[model samples]
Target: MDNGSFALMQQLEQLYIDHHSWLSSLLRRKLSNSSDAADLAHDVYLNLIRKGGVPSAENCRRHLTQIAKGMVIDLYRRRRLEAIHLEALREQPEPLVPSEEVRALAVEALSHVDAALRNQPSKARQALLMHKLSGMGHRDIAAELKVSVSSVEKYIASGLRACTPYAVKRRPFR
Candidate 1:
């Protein structure tokens, strides 16, 4: 490794030593789940490592906290989506309920879609959700989003393109 990369790694190690517990504690208080707190604490550092820089000492805690907060929000959003999916599944006929693997795959696919399009325009995300989940046509989605029908079509298409990289091939569920 180059000298700069080595120095950054060492700095990150020291930062982890200094801030990991504090980060975990902050997340635990916010999330009220120790396990998830620990997991997200690790994720925070991993994110830093991937970003390839250490924040200055004064800003380190703030940077870590921001990342942790975003992660916490994602965790809550994911749980909410999963709960909604579960409720819908529960309403289905027992015989029609999917296998556990199928259910897991469905949830994983939803997560991929969410993670992929999260940073896209809100109209895009909303249009796609309305079309797929609410079974609304483009005209209704355009009316709801207060955009032109063509704009709604573009939004849905953009959202789909964003998620294309994350798509997995489907297998027959049976």
Candidate 2:
């Protein structure tokens, strides 16, 4: 690695040595789970390493806290998505139940879709899910969202656009 990168790594290593425990303790209190806190603390450092920057000493705690908070939010969202997927699976008939591999892939895809929708407005996300997942028409979604049909259309379009990057190419089945 170049000198700048090497120096940054050294700084990060020192930072980790200095503050990992404090960060983990802080997260543990917030999450009320030692293991999750530890995992998120590690993720904070990993994210910093990925970004290839060491925060100033005075700002290190703030930076780490921000990363940890975001990670915790993502963890909660992922867990909720997984739980919802599992519940849906439980409702299927045994004969039509997906294989474990398929179930895993489905959950992963759902997480991707959730992540893609994370930044959309709440109404847009709700409208898209109601229309796509519940097979609700635009009028129905508009009624449920208490908006005009044109608004529902715009909301669904906004959600779909947010998810476009995560969309997989599909092939026609034989």
Which predicted model would earn the best lDDT?
1
lDDT of 2 at 30: 91
Give the poorly placed runs of model 2, Cα more than 4 Å off.
Answer: 116-174
Question: lDDT at 29 for candidate 2?
Answer: 95
Report the CA-based lDDT of candidate 2 relative to the real structure: 0.89
Off by over 4 Å in 1: 119-155, 165-174
lDDT of each: 0.90, 0.89
- Tens digits of lDDT, candidate 1, 14-74: 9999999899999889988899999999999998888999999999998998988888889
TM-score, structure 1 vs. true? 0.79
TM-score of each prediction = 0.79, 0.70
